[model samples]
Target chain A: MEQPMTPEASLRLIDEMLQQAKRSFSRMSFYFLLWGALLLVATLTEYAMNRAGLPNGWLGWPILGTLGGIISAVHGSREGRKAGASTFTDRVFMWVWMAFTFTLVIIIISCVQVGQRPGPWVSILTAMPTLISGGILRFRPLILGGVLFWVFGLLALFQWPEHGALLFALALLLGYIVPGFLLKRQEDGLRTA
Target chain B: MAFAPLDPVLHNQLRLAVISLLVAVEEGDFNFLLEKTGATRGNLSVQLTKLKEAGYIAVTKSFKDNYPNTLCRITPQGLSAFEQYVKAIKSYLDK
Candidate 1:
């Protein structure tokens, strides 16, 4: 039998284990970057098409959205297989993002039914997951990214409709792409260290 | 002032380490535990078995990528015991 440890040693052991477990949560920058870039492209394409007086300019969303979904699903499963273990933090992240996706779909469907543009609503909804994810990761960039989403979302809602897509794209760039790359760099540093 | 006795099952160094790790995560694999604890395979297996026997953790055996994989998750009972153990340890330190 192994020797019993003193209370002090036991406490230290617990702290070490907690820290190690925390480090095990793989920071997922790929999803953020991927979705961010895809949304940015889709929004820009929609804006340009509308300016060009092209019919069915809105088709950019459904098409790119489906593509994004497929890529996300594939990437998620690949990452899942590579992970040696699952932490509580990982599960929380999964559920939070899943809830966001669910809510987004509902919002889109509702907007379509009522003939309202889903742009502002989607932007507003994006803030929640981004903010919650930032809080969970304790990453300040993501927290600021979440705030940017809200600011742009409101601007898109009440400001110039013609420029709404531009504001949405700006939010995606700062809120998702920039922070995502920063997070990726941080994860890379940790991995290399 | 009386201090509560530490749970004997969790008093051992290796077992305590294993439980401490388990409490932090949803589930961990045999390799994860072995790597984290730096325990020999035989020793980790023994401690894991003991924890399973104590009903502190649920162990599942499965095959992943054509290799045997053992996953361990803390049970409600295990979490409760761990909480009590922390309280006991705190009380001892407080004294």
Candidate 2:
């Protein structure tokens, strides 16, 4: 039989578990980057088309939404199947993002119905989850990203509606893509060490 | 002074490790525990059984990718025990 654990050893075991749980969130950046790239592409395409005086420039959004939904579903299932453990922290983060996604969907639908640009609203909505997630994970870059999202979101709201797409695009790149890459790098470092 | 007595079920190194891990996470599969603990398959299996028998944890056997998979989760009883154990150990350290 294995020897009984000393109190010190037991404490160490608990510490290790906490560390592992924190590390489990490393892959979160991948999802952020994925959505960031998708939104960047869609918004930039719309902006270009509009500048070219093309009608139905907004059609790209529906196509992108469909693609995004399919990709998110597949990614979610794949991650779920491969995941080893589900921590309470993990569940909380999942629900936070899920709520964010739902709110974004509602805003998008409302914007379309009312014939208003969804850009500023989307950026503002994105800030809530980003800020909360950063706080949860204690990741500084994500917090900064959240703050920038708010800054750009407000700018998009007050600025020319014609520039809303560009502003939203900037917010995404700052709020998701850049921090996402940093997070990925940190994850890789942890793996190598 | 001697340290506080530890709960026999959670006193063993591997079992303690397993319970400690389960306390942090909602659930962990056999492979996940194996990976985290770096314990042999047989050793992990035995400790899991002990925990399950003590009503400190629950194990579920399921199939994934046409292969058998086992998942383990801590029970409320287990959580309470762990908390008490920690408190006891803390008292000993304070002394």
Q: Which stretches of candidate 2 lie over 4 Å from their true place?
A: B91-95
Error of 2 at A147 (Å): 2.7
**Candidate number with greatest DockQ:** 1
Flag clash pairs in model 1.
none
The interface root-mean-square deviation of each model, in the order shown, is 1.7, 2.0
Give the Cα error of residue A24 in candidate 2, in Å. 3.2
Q: Candidate 2 chain B — worst ten consecutive residues by lDDT sum? A: B1-10
What is candidate 1's CA lDDT for residue A173? 96
Give the alpha carbon lDDT tens digit for every residue of B1-95 in model 1: 78898898998888988999899888999988888888999999999999999999999999988999999999999999999999999999998
* Model 1: docking quality category: medium
The per-residue C-alpha lDDT of model 1 at residue A161 equals: 66
> Ten residues in a row with the worst lDDT in model 2 chain A?
A17-26
Tens digit of lDDT per residue, candidate 1, span A37-81? Answer: 989998999899989999887888888888988998888777766
